[model samples]
Target: MPVWGWILIAVIVVIAVVAVIVARLVSSRQRTERLRGRFGPEYERTVGEVGNLDAAEDELAARERKREKLDIVSLPPEARAKYADSWRTVQIEFVDNPSSAVGAADRLVIQVMRERGYPIDDFDQRAADISVDHPKVVENYRRAHSIYLAQEQGDVGTEDQREAFVHYRALFEQLLETDENKDKPKETRA
Candidate 1:
């Protein structure tokens, strides 16, 4: 091959590579900006809700303890031997459903917050109030949970589903935090 031809090919390759790199960079930046714009102040507030994190952590720990204590129930006689331990393991693993884990975690936070005298309300009514579902909290939880599950299962692209998962998780977490904050004791005058 002629040297000029070789040099021309090299330049063409370099231009193609540079174009791809620039395109990828632009796409990534746009995705980040979209997420920021979509989530906005609510995202920041949700991230700042320390109480929700603490509550979720505590509830997860409690679930582990409860799993240890659950009575081992028998399956049907024909399947009992093969499925006995299987059932227990599934229960321990949140019924082998990642979405269930998210729901459980959210419910645990709400329960803890309510026990702490938070004004936690019905999930159904909250959903209706938000004009989404009758059980707003659970509906949001499931949507976010499903995104997480889809991401885990490799059923969708991570970036899009992850953005959705984080967004809904934040919304629900903030709801719990707001419920908890509403129940805070008022300051007494000296």
Candidate 2:
């Protein structure tokens, strides 16, 4: 009730404020780390696109929530074999018509995505959804899509088209392999 009591109260309040601040900072840092690890390069891409960390984190979190609600399923063995055969046909066609081959590759990838239960209404949304489970190959999907866009504009060269096919193949292979691996025995998976 005197000078000493007032001073003690002020010190305690300051300590409590500092503790709260520190706790918030630590919590923020941990959230960032978790998002970074889960999203990988997609995290940086989102941050770059959104121009801020908080918004990017929010977007990534929203994608995670949306992904949780979706019923993404693996392809059946017959479907897998059919898609593989279609891909082989596309590759063979590439020798005669690179442009059409690239176009077919793009469509095939989207078809595979659709068959795997991904919504194919929007390219960006499709990429975001795929990033949730296929973070590593999502970039390849983006790059392939970009090339496809350039091809549509007649801005891509033969070499660029080839690169796009390669990128699409990367994503296609990942998608196919993931479906196959899901069906494999636990002991057979590495």
The most accurate candidate by lDDT is 2
Model 1 lDDT-worst window of ten: 181-190
lDDT of each residue in 1-190, candidate 1, tens digit only: 9999999999999999999999998976675454335344323333355346445334333433543453423223444333324323423544355444444444543443344333348653232222211122333444654565565676755354434434454443343333442322222110
The digit string of per-residue lDDT tens for model 2 on 59-93 reads 99999999999988878878888999999999988
Q: Clashes per prediction?
A: 4, 0
Best by TM-score: 2
The number of clashing residue pairs in model 1 is 4
Which residue pairs show collisions in model 1? Answer: 123-135, 124-134, 124-135, 127-136
Q: For each candidate in the order shown, give its overall lDDT on alpha carbons.
A: 0.43, 0.85
